[model samples]
Target: MALAALLAAPAAHAISGVLDTVVIMQDVTDSYKWPREQLEWNRVVAQLQEQVHTTERLVQRADRMIELMGTAENAADFSAPPSVMTPVNQAVRLETTKHAIESSRNLFRLGSKTRSTYNPANEVKATFEVAGATETRDENRYAHFAMQEAMYARYRTAATHEEEVQGAETALQEETLRRLKQVKTEAQIAVLTASLAASKQRQDLAHQKTVQAKADLDAFRAQLTTEEARKQEADREWSETVVKRMRDKALTAYRRQFRAVGSESN
Candidate 1:
């Protein structure tokens, strides 16, 4: 009877070991496959990232296109229409970029750790601290590259718009001078002078309009620059927040795994 009981004990231990392996395997699989709620959050985050990247690239390209249009001598020609198109295009692009950013922010808020009632701030701080101790320089390099590209593009566009306005004014002046050369008699000169005065008045009005437009453009560009800087800072903060949350979740899972292993050993 003692020999039979001892033999049965080994069989019972083997059965328990098999059951434990199955339970652990199921837990690991479930852990790896995120819950439906977390999966939705991840999807939102991915979408926001893609939209932000796309908007950044679009703004950058628009800036370059505006610059390239500005550099040509005949940019103010009626056929080109760049004077009106450039600013309008930039305004549209900027508005689009702004919308994209706002949308991203909404999605980020929706998917944030705070939404889960998780204490993300401490985790975020720790993540950033770790990143700072390790790969901060690399992250900064990429960030600067994006920033420089956007700045150069914006500057080139603004410069181009200013040049276009100047060229248009210069052309109008030359036209006025050429008309004055054709005057002969006092009557003709009087008519020409009156027409010239009117033309000058019109040119002055146009110049004023140009100056106002340029001012508005400059203001818009400055706003964009300020917004971009704010966005960069926000992105770094968000990254830190995400890292902290992930680290906390990972540690929790690690502890659970340790406990499971210890139980299996017993």
Candidate 2:
């Protein structure tokens, strides 16, 4: 199996429909029911988090999208966007996804370590210590060894479960993608329209927050710069003088004066 395929192997708390990730990079306007749309949206978000490794940009992008639509609800309710908004905001959707993926890749460079740690027992090395040595352990060590064996058995069980999930996901991938891309009925379009309207309402509420966040970020950056400069000035505030030195010499200099390092033996 590919290294990535192995690392992101199923975990106990993993979300369902997550492996339905083969998106058709198209200008999608399918009239799927709001609930199904919601499911697909969630799957995309979950997959992005898993594949890319972080959700900072996803959150930011979601915030931005909500702001654009002029409603608070869109932030949490992605499946049902406003029907009045025609053609769908493909740029926003694709850009948000691209940014989300990129941010995760950068933010979680060490994600593999965390992934391995999830199955801690399975991560055990073939040659780990027993009584401070790898080979020729005493009889007393076997109990400890046996305890580890039990732990490893649990790991094996977890691995088996993961493999089953992977197999199921593999079978479902194509079908899920096709479902997402399929055309919708008139009734489905009506539902989608309502979903879109709700989404737009949420998008409307998001704009002011986005503006406020940008302002806050700038202010924080400026404050940080000013504070850093003040810190540097404070570091140089003390004078390096003979009178000052006499009153309070540094510990290293004091140690050097008292100890003859080259000639000393403990």
Index of the highest-lDDT prediction: 1
Query: What is candidate 2's lDDT per residue for 136-192, written digit by digit as tens?
Result: 324332333333333333334334433443343333443334443542333343444
Per-model C-alpha lDDT, please?
A: 0.51, 0.44
The TM-score measured for candidate 2 stands at 0.20
Lowest lDDT block of 10, candidate 2: 86-95
lDDT of 1 by residue, 1-266 (tens): 99988866533222324644632223324444577769799999999999999999999997776554443342322222454335434432332233323343323232234223246552321123454574223333233333333333344444554455456545655665675575433444445456545544544544454455446545666876897899999999999999999999999999999999999999
Query: Which model scores highest in TM-score?
Result: 1
Single out the weakest 10-residue window by summed lDDT for candidate 1: 71-80
Model 2: number of clashes? 21
lDDT of 2 at 200: 45
Give candidate 1 misplaced runs (Cα > 4 Å).
1-199, 255-266
